[model samples]
Target: AIQIAASRDQLDPLLLSQAPGISFKYWKDATQLYLQQIDRLVAKGEDAKLAENKPYGGPVFRKMAVQLSLHDLKGAVTTLVDARLFQEAYVLSRTRYMDSLAEQTLRLWAHDCFLNGHYNTSSVCYMALGDLSQAAAALGKSSDEESLSLAADIAKVLGQTTFAGHIEEKREFIKSKKELLEKLDKQVEDQDLKDLPSRSELVIKENNTEKSQLEEPEKDTENAKEVASTDEKNLMSDTQAEESGKGEDENKIEKLLVELPEKMEGLLKDGIQNGMHKGDGDTMQNGEATDPQNNNEILAKPLQNGSEPVQEKSATE
Candidate 1:
């Protein structure tokens, strides 16, 4: 039993060796038999005696309940129902702390039974809990009593009595949908099967790309070296001259920058404070400023020869 519980995923031939009296040849078969026997005892309403057989029953049933919770309802319901029966048999002795959990477990068990098309079992479960609404609801009966003239549709359906089979059909449809969904999920998984690249192969590709990009620059440098080799004397002379020309350009730029602030300050002060003479009032026409005073200050600033002077400041400066 320990081996069966411990290694549910793996084969447990050791259970057969351990419990030689029983046919524990297959773990699945063994567990199934154990479950069936408990279910039978619960059905017979011998729940008190069933609970007394704790050595064989309690753990098996508890495991089964967990399995059902994980959606293995078909495999687990036999034992789960028995466990509920056992709990009911000892309801008075059962811990107050565990009452809600037991009720919730029974409710889930009822849902599983209904989902598996055991509506009679579901009805029994709900009836035992005194949940008439759910019991009748499971049976396609009305939750509320109504006057004959204002009867619920469920009452009408129940009166006809063919609706009992409809619930079974719905259960079967749910099973089929579950199977279909399983197949589709498997198909999706199969479709997305991936072959991951080996780390060494990925590393090799990355290293090759890096090497190629590095070699490209080296190749261009080599080409430049070869061209320079072919015209060594001319290359050397041209390089020296180019360097000298750059130095001269830098010096000239420095001189311009040094001279610029004084030149700019003088020009701006003269332009703003000392007004330029107009030729004559008649020489100018319309509303325009006359003669050299008519110069556009903003445009004229740019014409004063700083290559990249900004417009607004140069105008006001």
Candidate 2:
């Protein structure tokens, strides 16, 4: 808890080892040594003189933190506001849930900054306080178009259309820029929506292709086995047919060898018969055929004719 308190803020240290009289440097122009008079008055319980030179000062921070711990939040916040440390004042006011007091202090801070010519800070304070009118008015008095355009949007939201229209007309370039940015944002959203479905479709197609590829290897393996089996059957049939053909050819050769001797003997017998017939043909040519009937006929025919007996002439003669 002590560390948390010590670490709550760098400027607003939650815990301080020194009191009002034992101050450290918080401002540049004045140091604790110069404010020793105020410390002496605070130590002596002289409350009136403690705020003599300055109503709220750097030397009183320790006392303020002490007062906050003691639940004197109202006094602490009031003292912080008088010290012109609105940030600290606002923090205490917000933490303590003093809504009315916070609102008052916020307006006061904006008003103070505006009077001090810190229009941008004043605009921011007004924005934080949700006073869009004051924020737009304050930004209009400054030179930043973007922040002014933002204030114009707040004004539009609050139904200050005239102010919004005037701001948009004054900063036409900024208006066009904002429109272009809005157009780009919408286009990006539409493109993203379109890509969503295409991405899913691509994933589905890739998965289908992968599944087919996985199944094709198995199919190819089966086809290869079938082709191999058929090739083996054809090879075996071809081998058997070749062996049978060789056996048939050998049988034909053996049968031809066995019949060749008989064929030659038959040829020899026919040749001897033909030679005998040819030898008989020489006698037949001399008109000396061995037929007795032919000889008788020839003699009778000569006797009956009662002429000279005709003699047969041999073909050789």
Q: Report, for every candidate in turn, its global Cα lDDT versus the true structure.
A: 0.56, 0.68
Q: State how far residue 111 of model 2 sits from its true place (Å).
A: 1.9
Q: Model 2 over residues 1-317: C-alpha lDDT tens digits?
A: 23332232211223332223233343321333334544555687864743334223356676686676566878888888888989889987998799998988999999999888788899889888877789878876654577667867877888989988877777776667878999999999998877445788999999999999999999999999999999999999999999999999999988877666556545544654464466458667865544445443543442222233443432333
Give the least accurate 10-residue stretch of model 1, judged by summed lDDT: 142-151
Clashing pairs in 1: none
- Looking at model 1, residue 22 earns an lDDT score of 33
Which tens-of-lDDT digit does each residue in 150-263 have in candidate 1? Answer: 222333444634544454455556567878999999999888886778999999999999999999999999999988887997888899999999999999999989788667
Candidate 1 — which residues are off by over 4 angstroms? 1-90, 93-122, 126-161, 191-193, 215-317
RMSD in Å for all candidates: 25.9, 18.9
